[model samples]
Target: MTPPAVVEIDHRDPALQAAFCDYVPRVFRTVDFRRWCEWGEWNDDYRAFAVLDEGRVVANASVMRMRLRIEGREVIGYQLGAVGCVPSHRGRGLSRGVMSAALESCGEAPVLLFANKNVLGFYPRFGFKPWEQALFGAAFHAVPGGEPAPVLDLVEAHVREGLVSLSEEGLAVTERFGSRGHARIASWYAANAFSRPLRQLHADAWVFAGVENGTLYIDDIFAREPFDPRPHIPRLIDQPITAVHFGFTPERWWPWAGVAGEDSEAYLFVRNLGPPSGPHRFPVMART
Candidate 1:
């Protein structure tokens, strides 16, 4: 068998980067390639690894530098995404080679990823173990005399600035959870998740959300201080939302009235390179 050449492309190289983006859709057709490229937190530091067979890109993996709060301290973390292998190259070990390269680059930093159901057994070979995640859902209610919350376009500059403020505040509160690691929100996350920021009654507070299937998903709630989201829920959504779902749990809040459900589509797996700890929990917003 002929060996495939493996190379890492810097996102700054326009020609190589465009080819990488174009290749991803062959495996993941559910998302709009152009928009998916714009989604998530990406920067010049991000590395895209590809396996070239006779100079054509076939297998790919993405390694991203991320910040996470670990054991009450801010630390650099890594996330792996965009893992795919062209259909014709399925049994070539190209996907494994690309992932090995991505994990090697992570070194000792903690690594996390969401894997498709079919590939759930693939990551275990690399020391990654499946972790159960809890999803909380509750019936939506209206607050008397509440005004509708305006949805701001995340692509706009001013709106992104506001999201930054909320994210910073949210991170600060996340520290109090100690021992849990949460991915810090980047400016591009809003675009990736198609999130909108809603105005809160409290000055400088905002709720980030996205809608699907008549349900409003609360990605994250940010405020100068921790506060109850129930009171502001009515004003934060304009549609006749059937229920409100918590994506990530903020400090001091638990889904007491909500039912817990398991995520059957995607499974979270982690390979801890740092200290040995118990199962870690991250909010839905942190899912990359």
Candidate 2:
């Protein structure tokens, strides 16, 4: 007769963390929080509010503390993710309970999330407004003498270590809009997102890129120093024939002003943070 109580998942407790992990893939088929946790990148920044049904997570919502750069200013915000209620738990307002608890924990901090087409109308009930995202792109031509960038296997310890180092020491890839402390989320994508590879440009520079249908999508770059990645773009793909697009703001990496167009796939919703006046794309790797 009584509803299950929502509780905060304690990442410090392995059992609770495992329970949370088991519940996640049931909702998000592509995400693997367990693998990310095994890599030891899961930290206190990510907090989950959940409803437990006999030691198993049945409904959940989470908030990730983010160090974000918006309009050239550094500010702390929150990201909402891992939100769902199991099929058996649906229609009982369990999701609403957990979401309210998660937002309450965030107080007045800005929160953002990427929702799928199915849930397009669910978030607005919580005061989240849909924000438009732009894709920045330019023409591409492979350099005549370019060699393919070496792809690193993320399964290798050293390769993962290299990304960890760059994530900690590298300069901000963009000042327009992106995440700062995003190493953990980046690692999550590295592990679970199939086919996307980590390519080495310089000894200290690595990029999460993929080639599809003659187009190269540079999702995000990790570099230990300030450097132009344009020259190395040709090396990223051996047979590029179409355009190159950046998943984040490209002002710091490219010389030319790229053309901007609406990103239909970017279903971004925000609370407490006004959208930037100009075009911008949040780093693909930073989304939780």
lDDT of each: 0.64, 0.83
For residue 40, model 2's alpha carbon misses the true position, in angstroms, by 1.5
Give one digit per residue, the lDDT tens place, for model 1 in 130-219. 776556677765433466666666566566656656665554434421222222333345545545554455656666665666677776
| Residue ranges of candidate 2 with Cα displaced over 4 Å | 1-4, 143-147, 255-257
Residue-level lDDT for 268 in candidate 1? 78
Top-TM-score candidate index:
2
Worst 10 residues of 2 by lDDT: 139-148
Model 1 vs. true fold: TM? 0.79
- Tens-place lDDT digits, model 2, residues 51-75: 9989999999999999888978888
Per-prediction TM-score to the true structure, in the order listed = 0.79, 0.93
